[model samples]
Target: MNMLIFKRFSLTILILGTLVACKETNKNPQKKISETITSETQNDFLGNYVAKEYHQRTEGYDWISVAVRNKGDNTIGISVRSRADKKRPTCTFDSKAFKVNDSLYRACSNGVGILFSFKKDSLKILTEIPEQADALQFYCSGGGNFTGDYGRIEGELDSSQIDPTLFTKTLELQGIGFSVSSFARNNKKILQILPYGLEIDNSAITRTLEGSIADVEIEDLNSDGFPEILVYLSSDGSGSYGDVIGYSVNNGKSISAIYFPPISENDELKKGYMGHDEFSIIETTLAQRFPIYREGDTNANPTGGIRQIEYQLVDGEASRKFVIKNSTDFPEKN
Candidate 1:
C-alpha cells in the first residue's frame, strides 16, 4: 500500500508539469510570429523602383522613381523622385503593407495605393488614384490614368538620374541665389502635385487627369511683406488648362504647400471649369478664366462665351470673391 501511494503521487506530478509547459508555449506564440514578420518584410520589399515609361506626360520626358525604405518599429517610408527637376518628395507616412499574392504586395497611404510586384532582380509597380474623397477608389480604370510599371534600378537611389542642368534652370527660374549642388544636398525632394476629377450633380462621368508644373510666380497674396511663391501648374497632365497656387515660405526657408479649395464639376457656373481654366495672381486675389459652357454645349462649339472666377485669401483660406460671367473674356492662345 505504501508503494502504491508513492507511484500515484509521481503520476500526478508528471501530469501537472506537462500542463504548465503547454500553457507557457501558448502564451508566447506571438513572439515567434513577430520575429517571422520582421524577417519576411526585410527580405521582401526594400529597394528602388524606376519608371518604365519615364514620361508620364506627352511633351516632356521626366523619369520618375520610387523608393521603399524601412523606418524600423514596423514603419515604412515612401518617396517619389522626378528626374526633370531632381525633386524627390515624401508623399505618404506610417504605411502598413500586406501581401496580396506570391509576388504582389499593396500599401496604401494618403488616398494613394501603391501595388508592388516583385521579380527576381526587379520590381514592377502600379499606382492607383481613387475618385471619391470619402470612399476608396483606384486609378487603374483601363484608361491609363494612374502611373505604374516601373523596374528596379541598380545601386543606391539618388538624384543622379536627374539632368545636371535641371538644378541650374530651376534656380534661375525661381530667382534663388543658391548653388545647385548645395540646394540639391539640402532639399532631397520637392512637392509632387497630382490631380483628380470630382463627380458632382449626379454626373456619371468624371474626367481623368495628370498634372505638371507649368510655371512659378512670386507674389504676396496675403498682403504680407514676404513674397508668396505662386506655382502656375496645369492639370490633366496636358496644357489644356492652368491653376495658380499660393505658397508661403516657412521660417524664410522651406516653401509651404497651399491646399486649394475643393473645386467641383457641378457647381452651376463653375461646372466644367476645372482643368480648363487659366489662373493668375492679381494683387491679393487669384483670377481664373475659363470658357463658359452653357447647357447642351459641345466641345467643338463651346461658344457660350467665357467666365472669370476670382478668389481671395481669408485667414489663409481661399474664398471666392465673385464670379463674372460675360459674353467675352478670351485670352491669347498658347
Candidate 2:
C-alpha cells in the first residue's frame, strides 16, 4: 500500500480502539458506594441495601441504606445513612458490627445496641435489648428508630448521596461510638470519623491521612467510663512506619481530641526508634511497642531489643494527650 493509505488505515484503527475503551469505561459512569470492585449483584450481603417508605399521605420520608463491605470474614464494615428534611439530613446510624454468633451481628453505641441479620435478599436491623431500644430516641427524631428491613439495591443508591470510601469500621465503649473511614480525593488520602448518639450535635471529623488505617481500638484509658478511640495508621512503603490518631470522650457529654507525641520529639524515646510501632490499650493505659535497633542494625534486624512505652491519659491545656508513664526494654528473642 502507499504511505498515505497505510497511515490512514493505522489512524482508523487507533480511533476505533480509543472509542471501544472509552465506551467500556463510560458504560456505567455512575459511581456507587462500595469498598471494592466486586460483582454488583453478588448473592452475598456485601452490596448496597436500601429502604424507603412511600405512601400517598407521607409528608417527610425516610431513605436509608446499609452498605456492607466485601470482606470475606464475618466481621464487616457498615455505613448506614438516612435522609430527611433540612433539619437533619445525614447518617442516622453509623457503627461497625461484629459477628456475635452463627448468624447474628451486633453493633453497640452510646448505650444502644443494633442487631443486623442478613437474609437471602435483604438485611434486617433492629434493637434486641429492650432497654437499649429506648436509647434510639437520640439517633432519630419524630419518634422513629433505625429498626427496619432493607432490600439489596443491586448497585446504585443515588451515587450523588454516597461518597465512595476505601474502608470503614467502628468501635464503641461506655456508650461512645466512633465510625472511621478512609477515602482518596485529589490524589491525597483523607481520614474521616463520625461520632453518633452523642448528647451534643454529632459532628464529623476529617483530616488528611498520610497512610492507611492498620487497626482500631477503643478503651477507657482515663478510667472515667467514657472511652477513647485509637486509630492505628501505617505509612505506605516497605518501612511501614506506624502512628496513631486518637480521640477521647468528654464525660459522656461530647468528644475531645487526643494527641500522640511523636517519638522524635523526645531524644531518649527517639533513640533507636525507627518506626514499626504497634499500639494497643492494656487495662487503662495506652501501650506502644517497637523494636529497638542498634547502631549497625537494619530495619528488619534489630539487635538491641524490644522497647515498650506505656502512656497515661492526662488532661492537656488544650486537649487530652498521652503521656509517657513508663518505659521497659526486653531482650530480643533467639
* Model number with the top lDDT: 2
lDDT of each: 0.42, 0.67
Q: What is the lDDT of candidate 2?
A: 0.67
Candidate 2 ranges with C-alpha deviation above 4 Å: 1-164
Q: Please provide the root mean square deviation of candidate 1 (C-alpha atoms, Å).
A: 27.0
Residues 67-155 of candidate 1 have per-residue lDDT tens digits of: 66653223344444445453432121122344544555455433344555566546654443323222222211222322345676666
- What is the number of residue pairs that collide in model 1? 4
* Best-fitting candidate, scored by TM-score: 2
lDDT of 1 at 138: 22
lDDT, candidate 2, 242-323, per-residue tens: 8889988887778878999888889998898887776656667777877788898888787766677889989999999999
Please report how far candidate 1 places residue 96 from its true position, in Å. 43
